[model samples]
Target: MDLNLRKAILSNIESNDQKQLEATIVEAIQNGEEKMLPGLGVLFELIWKQSDEQDKQEMINALEQGVKQETTG
Candidate 1:
């Protein structure tokens, strides 16, 4: 069986509006199930693809800070 997980994730959310997208993300995160990780990865991939260099840098910076806090706190 051939499965395109990224395509499936995109298709599932293609019709969502901004609020719906926010809700989806928030709900998935709150649930914290391993199955939701792939969907979040797809969303992050889309965001990364669409981001400009500055935006990418900002995300990296935020991620670095988050990692540091997690490790040190």
Candidate 2:
């Protein structure tokens, strides 16, 4: 089967307003389904690609803190 996941997801969300996008992301995370991971990954890819160095560093720092919290707390 041929598939274009990223294209399809982008198309699906293209018209979404900020609230709609937030709801979609929140619902996906709250549901915690494995099937939703690819969509979340695509969203993360979009964020990463658009971020500048400082933004990327902040994201990395936040991720590091999250990992540390997970391990230590």
Candidate 3:
């Protein structure tokens, strides 16, 4: 990750009051959000780190094949 982005995240975390974070967490949990506010950023980071162009292409190809097979069947 870029140093600036890391710093910005740290800064945002540091800047937010704890009560607000707790409220946000409560809302996310209560609403059954697939992605909690806190985890969304980390989830994005993980996906970005793990997927390359080639991996994306392979995934698209697999999906295309599955669709074709379904249609033919």
For model 1, residues 1-73, the per-residue Cα lDDT tens digits are: 9999989999999999999999999999999999999999999998999999999999999999999998999
Model 3 lDDT per residue over 1-73, tens place: 4467555555655556779766655676698776465454653464567999998788679879999998999
Better structure of 1 and 3 per lDDT: 1
Every candidate's CA RMSD: 0.9, 1.2, 10.5
Whole-model Cα lDDT per candidate? Answer: 0.97, 0.95, 0.66
User: Regarding TM-score, does 1 or 3 come out ahead?
Assistant: 1
* Whole-structure CA lDDT of model 1: 0.97
Model 2 residue 14 CA deviation (Å) reads 0.7
- Poorest 10 consecutive residues of model 1 by lDDT? 40-49
Which window of 10 residues has the lowest lDDT sum in candidate 2? 35-44
Structural similarity to truth (TM-score) of each candidate: 0.93, 0.88, 0.33
Candidate 1 has which clashing residue pairs, if any? none
- lDDT for 65 (candidate 1): 100
The collision pairs in model 3 are: none
Top-scoring candidate (lDDT)? 1
- Candidate structures ordered by lDDT, highest first: 1, 2, 3
Q: Which residues of candidate 2, in runs, are more than 4 Å off?
A: none
